[model samples]
Target: MESRELAYFVAVAEELHFGRAAERLGIAQPPLSRAIQRLERRLGVTLLDRANRRIVLTAAGEVLLSEGRKALTALRSAELRARRAGRADPRLVVVMKPGGDAGLLERVLARYAEHPDAMEVEVMICGIGEQEGLLRDGHADLAMLRIPHDDPTGFATEELLTEREVVVLRRDHPLAGRTSVRMADLAGENFPRWSEECPASGQVVRDTGQVAQMIALGQAIAVLPESVTLTLRRDLAVVPVIDGNLTTLLLAWSEESRSRPLAAFVRTAAEVAAQARPAEIGA
Candidate 1:
């Protein structure tokens, strides 16, 4: 399908409202509707289920939405990479959440600079769940983030460090004095929701500081990477989450990325990660 048609479908699918999607795409509603109708006829499959005047994606639509996003991102990446190819001075952009690198970033950059092929590096501090998009869209040359052991990511990555999580709560909370606590020990305690799919959480948190504030106010407790304690407030206390899940802080980059500078940086990061595994090293 044409990029314009695919983009239109994606917009409509995300909004689930023709009017809002048209407004977002800067097009009239009638033409948008016709474009969708024509696309459905051409594809010979009903993408959206228009029942009871409500719009919902059909099974086929869901597959397209997932794959279409990748296609669009790949197309954008090609354009960006092509433009960078013609530039006189090419630089690398690294994206990560604040403190996501587990104190390895500064050292990594320092080591990479000593490499024979190192170039300019720009660091982009992003919010939760934005690193992958930035990398896929060619806005970032590399990323350092944590993921579940079983999580499947299509990016090219190298395992950096794996550590158990910790629990952050109000300094005066009852559990703050404990040496450690099991995941089950947190029962009935408020937790911040990192995403809509996460379960058994109270307030939705958009950033690290917001979650820290939630814990500082005694409104919520968060299970996070141990490195987060480095930035915790005076009113916040961190305790080892003895039985919490293991999170791996890894260096991630696009599968399509094949620059010499990118390779040098990734190798430097891996070398740095090897020597920096902290006290807890089971995972």
Candidate 2:
């Protein structure tokens, strides 16, 4: 019913650990538990199933979590509309894949900073699955994703860049000095496979964290987006994949988002991509 209650529910649902949720919300565990209890009482439904050492959401909790996020998104849009009408200010929401190109976003912000209207751009790190959901549910105006989206009927997509896959290895590895590497060369190498929940999972990786750890330990080779590999551990050497294909990074949004600040962002991204000259582009 209240925004604070919704916030508490979301926090707990995300963490699933009472103490951790409390810590994340900047409160003690007792009050957090009490708040959950109150929320359950108010809704007349059990939201969580708690065991000795674990907590899991009930079906009711799952429904609430989904609807609550939609409600919160609508609230944000309402606030933005009010702000725009009163002060000629605009706001844009963008969800990005983790370890994405911050430099590119920075360029867009710098280029659009001189606009007459006051504007705010909110950026959040989200998974690939969440990106399209966020936009369709009105929580976000745009998203940057690792894989190319196949469906583009009601949405517009701009090919920002294609990032080469690179082999990440420890400096001590024998293959570190190679000008380029191949996946087969690391056949026996314990690749960093991404978890099924990870964005890169099932794409070209085995396990994301595990592979990263192996690469860090010089036990196996891991192939990752050049942008991501470069941004991660500097101790790891990243060499282009001589025969590997690249992942296409794209900017996508619904057509309805075109009239809002999202349009400005679309244009800014195009300009920034041209100026940055990231990797290669295809027709």
Candidate 3:
């Protein structure tokens, strides 16, 4: 089937609303409706179950949607690789959130530079929960993401580091003086949430910086990786959360990526991780 037809079918399948899908595709409703109808007829299978106010995917539609996404991702990856090949200096883009690398980014980069076949590496700092999308959509070659906070499915990943989590609170807060705290101690506390556009869960805030500001102002508290303390303002305090989940940092790349530079960088990351201090690298 043509990519365009697959695109149209996938949109409708995901949105489950013809009008919304048409709007997303920047097309009129009538044509989008006709296209889906034609596709179903061509395949001799009913793809969607349309009711008065609801739409659901049929078994065949579900299969198509799953496979279609992979096909699109592969196509985009090919296009991006082709474009990069034409560049004078082919570089691999490694995406991560600002201050999310747990102090290992510099070491990883320096190690990668020692490789004979290493290409220039570009770091793309994005917000939390965005790294997977960037890698999946072909905008980045590799990413450093925290497990549990970020899903690691559909890609290959190597664990670089893991650290104990800490709760960030105002220095004047009642529990801030403690060396460590339990999750139960902060049960009633307000936690800062990331912005609406970000997929992160919690009380709504624009960014990590804002979360810190809010904590200092006594608006909320947050549980984060211990590395966050390195950049915390003086007004804020980090108290270890003995019961909180350990945040693991990982280097992830798409399974479809065949870039030698990306492989070299991954190998370097593993070496750097191996050489890190045991106390800093966690269990």
- Candidate with best TM-score: 3
Off by over 4 Å in 1: 15-20, 37-62, 84-88, 149-152, 279-283
**Could you give me the TM-score of model 2 versus the true structure?**
0.59
Alpha-carbon lDDT of model 2: 0.70
Candidate 2 segments exceeding 4 Å error: 1-90, 127-129, 148-154, 195-214, 218-220, 279-283
CA-only RMSD, every prediction: 3.4, 7.9, 3.0
Steric overlap count per candidate: 0, 7, 2
lDDT of 2 by residue, 93-183 (tens): 7877555553477767777666554268878777534666666556666777666332344568887777668888898788888998777
Error of 3 at 4 (Å): 0.4
Q: Model 3: C-alpha RMSD to truth?
A: 3.0
How high is each candidate's TM-score? 0.85, 0.59, 0.89
Write one digit per residue (lDDT tens) for candidate 3, span 1-283: 8899999999999999999999999999999999999999999999999977788999999999999998987888778767976789878899998787777778878878889879999999888678888888778889898987888898999998788889998888999899889999998788766556544345675358778778877888899988886677987888999999987899999886677888989988888887875356422
The lDDT, on a scale of 0 to 1, for candidate 1 is 0.85
Error of 1 at 78 (Å): 2.6
Model 3 regions more than 4 Å off? 28-30, 51-55, 195-202, 278-283
The candidates, ranked best first by TM-score, are 3, 1, 2
Candidate 3 pairs with clashing backbones = 193-203, 193-205
Worst 10 residues of 1 by lDDT: 274-283
